[model samples]
Target: MRTFAVLNQKGGVGKTTTAINLAHAMALRGHLVTAIDMDPQNHLTAGLGQETHPQVGIDEVLLAESDLQTTVIDARQNLQLVPAGTRLSEVEQGARGVKGGLLLANEIKKLERQDFVFIDCPPSSGILSMNAILAANEIIVPVSSDYLALHGMSRLMGILNHVEKRLHHKMTVWVALTRFHGRRRLANEVRDKLVNYFPGSVLKTPIREAVALAESPSYGQTIFEYQKRGNGSNDYSALADDLLHGRTR
Candidate 1:
């Protein structure tokens, strides 16, 4: 399985949006995808059109109170989810040692099913995000076009580097430019800088700043089913294809 964690310490940069849409788009392409909602908010779960059932979430697995098999809930066709819940906050506060950070990774290794696993990480550098890094084989960073968003890349890279050195994991990193507008000069400049800095690791397709992406979650749907004709749908689908086929390579 191509396990990836869609993460960014900075919130509101479309991390959850990318995770929800990308997973949906990948499933649309006939791949069996399992999206793990590691965030306490359960946005990915709700975005996939599944209600956040109480007492059923990553908290159960992380607390070692539930079996991995019993935790998975089916979403749309070809997509499954290990949903998140309100209890995640309690799980975070309770789980304290090195074992806590490895909880998600251990559960993931035991899964005999799944072609792709996308982990939707919380917007903080907490134990949950650490677990996502430890569990994933690669990291997909979704960044906006603003200059302030540019400042966050170094901090994110620093965390990954620490994980690589201390944990002895060799996970790859891919930086994706999101909410890009071609008509804006600043957006173009940011894209150029990102590609220059990231080199071959940057994805070719950029997600346009589309209102459809922002509105889809409200309707409990992905862009594919929400507004199929919009640029948001098209770009995300292309990104899903590239990610599935290893276009970054």
Candidate 2:
């Protein structure tokens, strides 16, 4: 199974949107995908149209009171979900001195038959985000097309380097541009700068700024289900294809 954590310390950058749509797109392609919502906000859960809360979720699993298999909800034919609740904040504050960084990694190992696992990390550095990075073999950092978004990437990379040294695991990191407007000169420049600096690490597709993406979660649907004709759907599908085929060029 390929484990990816969609993360950004900066909020409102389409991190959850990327996580949800990518999982949906992969499931649409017949890949067994499990989305683990590690954010206390639970936007990922609601976006997938899951109103029913599971008895146990990431909180219970991280606390070692419950396992992932028990908490996983069947989201779709090829998709599974591990929803998060407000108690997740309590777990984050208390998770310490117990090798908490590796808890999620241990829980993930118990899952079976999943082709892809996408972890929705919170928008801050904490025990929760640390556990996510430790668990994930791959990292997907979704950045807005704006200039300040570039600053966030530099900081995150430093953290990832520290994490790699501590965990003794090399994570494959990729940067995907979000909220991009191809018409904007700044957006095009930022994209090129990312590709130029990162080389093979940057995906070619940049998720364009779209109202459909913002409205989808409110309607409890992914972009593909919310508005197939929208740019959000097209961009995510392109992203899924890139991820599946490794067609960076």
The prediction achieving the highest lDDT against the true structure is 2
Candidate 1: clashing pairs of residues: none
Whole-model lDDT per candidate: 0.85, 0.89
Q: What lDDT is obtained when candidate 2 is compared to the true structure? A: 0.89
TM-score of every model versus the real structure: 0.95, 0.96
Clashes of each: 0, 0
Supply the global lDDT for candidate 1.
0.85
* TM-score of candidate 1 against the unseen true structure: 0.95
